[model samples]
Target: MNTYFITGIGTDVGKTVVAAIVTEAMQADYWKPVQAGELQHTDTHSVEELISNSKSVMHEHSYALRTPMSPHAAAAIDGVHIDLEMIEEPETENHLVIEGAGGLLVPLNEQETILDLIKNNYKVIVVSRHYLGSINHTLLTLSELRSRGLEVSGIIFNGKAHPTTEHIIKKMGHVEEIGRIDEEAVIDKQVIKKYAEMFKPRLEAL
Candidate 1:
């Protein structure tokens, strides 16, 4: 079974939305290892709401901190230390979509970062949204994954398209283009379904 690790160039880059679309497309199981905040409406809940697939299973989080801050800081505030060994991936036979918190280098604890959660076998999908320094962020993220000898399945561009930026990233990053999730007015199940269909071909090819 394929395991896709959904990460972003930065926070609010729409990793959860992309995870939902991928999960809907493959009817895969969903998991968010470390959730720093929004426990009431967690990423698992959000993905569950966005996806229409009945086969998808939303797994519980390892660490659900209270503050909407970095995992390390949030865990500190919650009076709990995020343990890497304790954050185990759920055993499943189906394809799994794992969403990470913040960026690739976001600290989970004093020693480990979000990147440490990614296994070598997992297909990493970097969700890149266009911004002032997004190009740099994208390259750095891809580079870091490559440095770790991780398998980067591809990149998913979120929000509006910036042709120049996209071109440079595709050429320089030397990564496959999985496609983009266009900006939407209302990103309901219908929207997620549409993107799922649009990205299914590429995702399957991965």
Candidate 2:
């Protein structure tokens, strides 16, 4: 089973939403290693609620901090430390969807960032939402993944379309454009399922 690690150029780039689509598309198990805050309503919960597939299982997080901040700061406030070695991946015979917090360079601890959580075997999917200066952010993200020798399966654009922005990023990054999640009035299970079906073909191709 292949693992898909969903990351983003920066925070609030709709990583969780894109993750839900991929999870539903592949009927894959879902896991978010470290949750900084909103313990009652975490990324794991969001995906679970959004997906309609019975095959998908929600895995527990490695660490759940009390504060809503970067993992390192949240860990410090909670009097804990994030050991990358201790952040183990859950076993699954089917594909697994792993979602990261914030961006690639966000710190999980002083010595490590979210980038460290990604294993070499996992196929990376970068989620990008258009915004001013997003071009630079997206390019840098792709560059870092390439430099690390990680397998970047492709990208999933989220929200309203920006032709020029998407065009430039696609041209420069040279990554697969897996699919896009158009602006949704309400992203319910139906919406997620619709995107799931649309993305399934490309995801399987990967």
Candidate number with greatest lDDT: 1
- Distance from true position, residue 148, model 2, in Å? 0.7
The 10-residue segment with the lowest total lDDT in model 2: 85-94
Off by over 4 Å in 2: none
Model 1 regions more than 4 Å off: none
lDDT of 1 by residue, 32-80 (tens): 9999888999999999999997999999999999999999999999999
Write one digit per residue (lDDT tens) for candidate 2, span 1-206.
Answer: 78999999999999999999999999999999999899989888999999998999999999999899999999999999999989999987989999999999999988899999888998899999998889999999999998998878999899899888888999999988999889889989999999999999999988
Please list the C-alpha lDDT of all candidates, in the order they appear.
0.94, 0.93
lDDT computed for candidate 2: 0.93
- Error (Å) of candidate 2 at residue 153 is 0.9
